[model samples]
Target: MENVSTRRSGQALLVWGLLVVAANLRASLTGVGPLLDQVQADLGLVPAVAGLLNTLPLLTFAALSPLVPRLAARWGAERLLGGALMVLTLGIALRWVPVAAGLFTGTVLIGAGIAVGNVLLPSLIKRDFPTRVGMLTSAYATVMGGVAAVASGVAVPISEVAPGGWYTALGCWVLFALVAVLLWLPQMRAPRRAVQAVRGHRLPWGSGLAWAVTAFMGLQSLGFYVVVTWLPRFLQDNGTSAATAGWLLFLFQAVAVLTSLAVPGVMRRAGDQRVLAAICSAVMFLGYLGLLVAPGAAPLWSVVLGLGGGACLVLALAFIGLRAQDANVAGALSAMAQSIGYLLAAAGPVVFGLLHTVSAGWRVPIVVMCAAAAGQTIVALAAGGGTVRPATGEVPDRVPAPR
Candidate 1:
């Protein structure tokens, strides 16, 4: 009985730790948009250079994601995660150095740290909570979205009172990362077994279903980042104040938090997720169309788009676990999907900004977003049809061997 109770207590701690990590992952990035204008003015950056601030992280995500699995294989996931948290802390702190070099350098470190967490967390969920993936995924996703919303909403206010202004607001995320690191420290002491490599078994890089899942992940991420990067500016352009635009962006993320919390369980039970995918796509399409046609109804469109974006994100993450055969494969597939997906997504904000610069309007960029939504719908249908392959074996639940 004591052993069982202790195990349960440990599990609970792990769950909370995971949630805290998830919360920090996006807060650092999403907080930037709300303070973007101020940062631009402070740094004397044009729109394209400002857009690169958002794009650079995605590029880092693309570049670093593939390497994380190997790092996990070597260092153990728990230790790697703890190390990543430390890096994230350093990165966020670097932004406060009050130089353009400091800002971009810190952003690069932040992206690299987040890239490891992004690829590893789902795999960790699969490995540690095999029977409760949907519930736990939903929980962490909810926390991630909710924290991101709060970060976006309060960024301007925080900057106003913070001594270093936008730099302080951006750098404050290190506190959250530091807390996560402390919470996660207990995990490093727990035993973990190394995942054995399967002989003659290569990852399904060419599988059609794998490609579908990758595409779905990419398109959904592309749409979400584009909004996170530009939604505040969009609202501000349509007669909303900067503070109001920040709250509206918060509304967008808050709605997503609700949807993300609810969607995973529904997806788990449904015979096929295609219907859900179709519904998500429709909501996104209408939301974008509404944004283009009726800037006056910004609040309504933000909710609609948030619902769609949130649902799509949950579905994409769930697919990463549900489609894999085991935690090891899940990690590999996650690396592949995110590597490709984020590379595809990295172009979104930069391209959106460049188009806005050349065309002198938001319409063309939005239309491109709508087209990405269409692509997402098509891929989600394919990905939702069924699982691609069963995991060969479960990764043993023990502390990974020392490097």
Candidate 2:
């Protein structure tokens, strides 16, 4: 009875922590897209150099991800999470401090904070809510996407009205971090052994299917970040007003908020993720087509892309749940996948911009993204087999029964 009560209490804390952390994930990531032009103009950033503002978070996520699990292992997950949130609060606060260097410096700090949160949350979910991983992951992703919608949608209007201008607009998100700080304090205070778990323990990364899962996640993220960083500019190039472009980005995040809830449940039940993967990639392809063929006529298509992309992101996380047979394995695999995968994904926006610089158009980059989608579909088929091979070398799909 005592164990049961303690387990329930831990679960409650886990859910609350997930919600608070999820709300902070995307604010720093997506908040600036709407205000990039304003920042560039105010700070006199070179157009090409301004692109790094969007790229910095991805770079930070990639570079910092491999360190997260080790840090969690050494310090305990709750303390690490709380400490990361402190970094996030400090970072978000710096953005409003009246210097361009502070702006860039703060953005880097925020990205590093978020990267730690990103890697740790999956381990927490795996450790605490093992059976409810899908549910918690879906809820967290939904909350994340919804907050992103609010941030992207409101950032420009907030900037227009704030006396300190875009700096104040960007600073508003620090309050979200502060909320996370308050909620996370108890967890930090909780006994360390209560939450600590062994790290660097997981399934061997030797399986073809495991590698496929990693690549699918990496490729899908590459395409998603490319769109996130460049889509508003893409719309502006086609003569859409800045506010409308921001709202279109909002539409993307908004649709993701819904799909993050719906698609994970569907994939959980359907037992075959291949079809869902195909549908997701298709939606993304068509969304880009809408941008190319008729920018204004069907904004809904872009929303669909958001739905699909958000679902893909959630499902990638879900793969860790569905694929792992235990928490230690899940955390280890999650670290491997995210550490290498984010590094690959980090290249997306920078490469997309370089392509545009050379081709002087979006068409070539669109082709590159489409090819990535095709690759995702193939890997999705392989990983969707719903097989979990433990560290033992047994092959589940093609093995005869043990004699």
Candidate 3:
């Protein structure tokens, strides 16, 4: 009885540790947007360079994801995750140096750290809580979204009061990463042999289902990151105060948190998630259209976009697990999907910024967003309906292939 109780205690600690780590993944990145203007002024960043703050991370995620599985194979996911937390902590702290070089360098470090966590967490969930992937994915995603919302909401206020201003507000996230590192230490001692054994299967790059999943991941990320990068500026342009705009961003993320917690379980029981995907696409489209047509209804549009974006995220991650035959395949698929997906997503903010710069209006950029929504709806439908064939490594024709 004592042994069982002790094991349960350990398990509980692991879950908590994972949740804490998840919370840190996005807070550091999301916090930047709320204080972007301050950072730009302080660092003397050009608009093009300012856009790099968000784009660089997505580029890093694309570049690093395929390589992480190999690192996990050699070092074990737990040890790698702990190391990532350390890097994240260091990155967050480095931002306090108050120089343009320090800011960009820290952003790179933060992105690298997050890239590892982003790819590994789904695999970790598959390995540690195989039976509870949906529930745990939802839980961690919720925590991640919630903390991100809080980080966005509080960034300006924290900047206003912190001794080092925006830098201090950005650097403060190191505390969360530090705690995650400490809690994750115990996991580093876990046996690495299992991770090594599963490292042999090549990712099915040729599979159509794989590309569908990749496209779904990419389109959703493109939309989400564009919003994350620009929504505050959009609101501010329309005469909203910085604090109020920050809170609206928070509301957008908070609504996402709720939907992330609910969407996976709801979809898991359905025969196919294409309908859910359609609904999500519609919500996002309407939100964008609302923004274009009725700038005054920002609050309603924010919630609509948040719900859509969050549901799309849950579905994307869930598909990584649900479509795979085993954890190894899941990991491989995750790497491929994320690598391709994020690279594609990296263009979103840059392109959106360029469109606005060229046209001198939000209308053109928003029309692009609406087109992305339509494409996401179509891809999600295909991805949601496709199935993986373990024997030949092909996607069977349950869903029509994207032409």
Candidate 4:
């Protein structure tokens, strides 16, 4: 009974600790876009360079993702996560240096830290809570999306009162990393054990299902990053108030939280998730269509976009664990999907802008995205069905398997 009690206590800690870690994943990055104007003025950066603050991280995510499984194999996930939080903290603080070089350096560090969290997290879930993937994925995703929206919403407000202006707003995220580091410290103390799993899993490059998953992940990320990058400016360009634009973005994220929560339950009950995938993609297409065809209904469109984008994000993340037979396979699959996904995502905003410039209006880009979202429906159908091909040398799937 005492051992059982101790086990329950540790499980509870892991649950809430994962939630806390998820909370930090996107808040820091999301807050920066809303405050980009201030940074641009303060640092004398051109618009081209100003955009790097966001894109640089995605680039880093792309570069660093493939190495996380190997790193986790050597250092163990808990210790690696702890080290990442420290890196995140240091990176967030480095932004206080107030130079363009400082911003680039800090952003790169932040991306590197987040990249590890992004890849290893699903592996941790697969290892620790094999029986509860859907539930836990939904919970953490809800937390991540909800906190990210809040960060974006509060960013302008925080800058208004933070005496250091945008610097304080940007630097405020450091507190979250600090807290996560403290919360995760207990887990890292177990290093007397051997290094974690995640070896013997190849990249799954030959698996068509794996490729489908990677494409789904990338397409969804591209849509999301592009929207996050430009939706505010798009709304403002059409004469909406700044506060309203921010709130609309918040509403988009808030709606996503609901879908993110609901999709996991559906995933568990359904034979396959193709229907959910199709419906979500359709909703996002309509949202993008509504924005282009009738900018006046931005709030309604934001809700639609959020409803779809949120679920797609969760599916993309959850599939990493759900599809894999074990933590080792999950880690490798995640590394592949996200490395390519963020590479695709990293190009979205730049391409959106180029289309806008070449066609001399946002309409061309919206049209392109509408087509892309339509393509997503097809990819979703493929990725959402059929058996997940396990990475090479993976053990058969297990239930309630502890790492």
TM-score of 3: 0.92
Candidates' lDDT values, in order? 0.82, 0.76, 0.82, 0.85
Candidate 1 deviant stretches above 4 angstroms = 194-203, 390-403
Give lDDT tens digits, candidate 2, residues 1-403: 9999998887687689879998999877788877888999999999877777777877898888767767887888788889999999998899987678889899999989998888778767776766677778888888887887788778888999988889999988898899999989888887876434425444347767778778877987887788778887887887878778777877887877788888756866775677787777666777766666666654666676786798888878777656665554555566667766888887888888899989999888878887777778778877665544556642222212110
- Candidate 2 at 279: error in angstroms? 2.8
Instruction: Report the error of model 4 at residue 82, Å.
Output: 1.3
TM-score of 2: 0.90
Q: lDDT, candidate 3, residue 171? A: 90
Query: How would you encode candidate 4's per-residue C-alpha lDDT over 300-341 as one tens digit per residue?
Result: 888889988999999888778777767777888899999999
RMSD of each: 4.0, 4.2, 4.1, 2.1
Model 3: per-residue Cα lDDT over 112-156, one tens digit each: 999988887876676566667777878888898889888888888
Which of the predicted structures, 1 or 2, would earn the higher TM-score when compared with the native? 1
Better of 3 and 4 by TM-score: 4
When summed lDDT is taken over every stretch of 10 residues in candidate 1, the lowest stretch is: 394-403
Q: How does each model score on TM-score?
A: 0.91, 0.90, 0.92, 0.95
Task: Give the C-alpha lDDT of model 4.
Answer: 0.85
Residue 336 in model 4: lDDT: 94
Off by over 4 Å in 3: 1-7, 193-198, 389-403
